[model samples]
Target chain A: MVREQEFLYASGRIRALETKLLSRTIVERILEAQDMDAVMRVLSETDYAPDFEELESIYDFEKALENSMKRTLGVIKESLKDQRVVRFFTLKYDYHNLKVVLKSRILGVEVPENLTTLGEVPVEELLKLSKGEKDVAVPKLMRLAFERAAEVYEETLDPQQVDLILDRALYEELNLLVQDIGHDFLKSYLAALVDLTNIKTMVRLKYMESDLRTLKKSLLPGGSIDLEFFEKMFQEPVPVLIEALAASNYSKVVKDGLENWVSSGSPAVYEKLVDDFLLGMLRKGLYKPFGLETVVGYLGARENELKILRVLMVGKINGISEDMIRERLRDVYA
Target chain B: MEVTLGQVLALLGAAMAVFLPGIGSAKGVGMVGEAAAGVVTEDPSKFSQTLILQALPGTQGIYGLLTGFVVMQRIGILGGNLLPLTTYQGLLVFAACLPIAIVGLLSAIAQARAAAAGVGIVAKRPEELAKGITYAAMVETYAVLALLASILMLFGLKLA
Candidate 1:
């Protein structure tokens, strides 16, 4: 009872912050805008207005988006009593930067793009760690995962192995983090994320006509659905997999995602459905009066909003048709 | 001036009436204040609106203090002549304080949660502040009833 009340301030702040989230209508308006300038105009009217004002150029949308993400996350971090909740949201970025740094080191190439500062570990520290410098303290889990992924890539000579190893390690760290936090809601959320990703991988590999060995290696552990279930479903056709999934919680997601995949010959719709499903799960925090749920849910919503903005901006820059961009658009939390 | 067992019990009753609900109200009001501060941090214009929600939980403490004040008066702690309460009468007074003391403690916390939720409403929909207050006020009804029961019991005691 006492601990739950600790979140009252964060819950109230998130509730207010929720009003600033872009609605589906606003996303559509951004989409309908004739040019990038019109998109900027649409965004300028929202909370992103302040972010845009500091931009060096109208095209520096990445800086604006990253600044906004960093600021929103900072707000959440400051308000949260349990910093582990922040780790739950941010651990991914650390793993992401690790992947970029380690892979570039392995390939002997210049780091391709900018490392996100959103990770719990700073980019500068991660870069130093990649250079085999031990001066900076990094999380033991990430350091071990990075070394292991590098070793696996060296042995297998497969870049895919790097991703699989790091991805598994990422989930492992998330699993440990949530366990330490000790919330059933967070544990279930982690399970769902793992389960959904495993399912997506299984479907994609099936389409690739990959061997069972490849599928076995790529599937992540700690999901509610065991490996045996994926192996069993892997042999059967897509329809049978759909039939099997109907009895599980992901029945609607699989059914809709698979049908779209079958019709469109693309996984874009499935990806979108997966995001929407996760957001829907996070939004369950809304029903809870006060707790970590609202805080985590708010973070998830902010991330989703950033993703939508990224897609819109990327599409506009590339001169993709609005309809094409709309096809790939995921649901907004607002 | 040795304190009699009866006087001790009567004093215990008055202390419980003041402190238990007072603790509850402090917790309740603090919770609402935290939530209200969150809203005000985002939009300072909502400060007055959220303050109203913060005040809702505070009534439980006041109700408790009122019950204590009446008990003090009845026992002559306020009137300057401590009543020579019988042990049975002291027990009765102690029993009377229970309704407000226990209820005030629990109801104030409950009302604070409702009022904190009202802060969320004020954050998003400032126009519906009344509805938020109404929900919080609903929790106040139980606290009010408990206060009334304690007051009535204190007044009905024939301590003369």
Candidate 2:
């Protein structure tokens, strides 16, 4: 199929789904729901209920919501059957599965069966791969990642390095795929990914006081930050770092965040600021002529909603008050 | 007969006008896609909100293209040549492409970063994504204005 035709079909399906996203009023009503069943009912009334019957409990309801979303997304992926978009989604799962497996193996922690299988690759296979027992193509495919991560492990044994390597490798692979496809939406999406990753890395390094070399090594090279500027920023004191960021495109947001961090002396504010900055960008970037944008955007929104739901659920289970939950809630954009 | 420097510059300007914004938008939107995928994997239901988030970075390319089309018309590349071929004319065309090209390049990428983070927001708080998108789009206004100014300049050149 022609790329344009695939995009048209995908966009059409996305439009249908987009129509069903909850409005402020609907979200408010859901928030006011007295119980899980009421919330489920609210969800069912909307377009999100296709797989609702599969739920067996409140937890099941959440799981089913996630699963249904995956199913729907899978359907959307089918629209791009001729393209590598499906592989893109599958790679995400692969990344997640690899992370879970590696973390479990390195920490000598037992892997939860449910947690293991949630991403692209099946949990069992991931477990085997983690144990160095699997000779499947995945290991070969991830050869670069394995080698890089091994080097990090040998050097510092910092599990974070493993994460950093995986993230960098996955992004590199994803970047190549996006470039090959050359769609406007996909390009923007990948760029955002790089930017966010950089922000996250910068924030973590800042908090940890890790040197520029370590931080630089951890970054995915193709991001917005140039190596020279990144090094300069890293060498500067925290105050200087904040000032440098404040002078750039991220100035206003980062400045405000820095002020808050200074006043509160809390790193959480910075983390939240990073979150806010990236979220704000994604919301505006997807409206133009790209079917992939819509699909990808919907996927993002769904994830945010789930995170909020999970927070709310945990609060409910713990008997936390709504007001407390409200206070604890990070700015949605943040 | 040889192509004058003036003619070469005009062509270069027009080409940049067309291609630069396209590059910017492509980069911007690609940035957001990564975040969107991550969000959807965690929760598929927030798709609509994430779509809006991802769309924020795409405007730079549109603005760039609009400017290019207008410049083409002004240069008589599309129709009539109202302006005489002067070094100044070439310079103006070159100048006109600069703001959109440079801003389009930088802001589009910046917005893409914002979109990636926006995806995270959607994943964690889908209902609040509109505000996030608005914030991301704010940066593109300057690029749009720059493109508009270039088009206006072309119109003025035609009148002159």
Q: What does candidate 1's lDDT look like per residue over A1-334, in tens digits?
A: 1267778888878888989999998999989989878988898899999998899886778888888989998887788676888888888888999998987887787664667878888787777888889776788888899889888888989888888898889988888888888888788888998998999999999999999999998998889999999998999999998998899999999999998998888988888888999999999777666788888888888888988998898898889998899988989886
Using lDDT as the measure, the top candidate is 1
Query: For every candidate, what share of the true interface contacts is present?
Result: 0.67, 0.00
TM-score of 1: 0.96
By summed lDDT, the worst window of 10 consecutive residues in model 1 chain A runs over A1-10
What DockQ, on C-alphas, does every prediction get? Answer: 0.77, 0.03
* Model 1 residue pairs with clashes: none
Please give, as one word, the docking class of candidate 1: medium
Model 1 per-residue lDDT tens digits across residues B87-120: 9889999999999999999999999998888888
lDDT for A75 in candidate 2 is: 68
Q: Number of clashes in every candidate structure?
A: 0, 56
Candidate 2: misplaced stretches above 4 Å? A34-38, A47-62, A86-90, A107-118, A147-156, A237-239, A265-280, A283-286, A319-334, B1-160
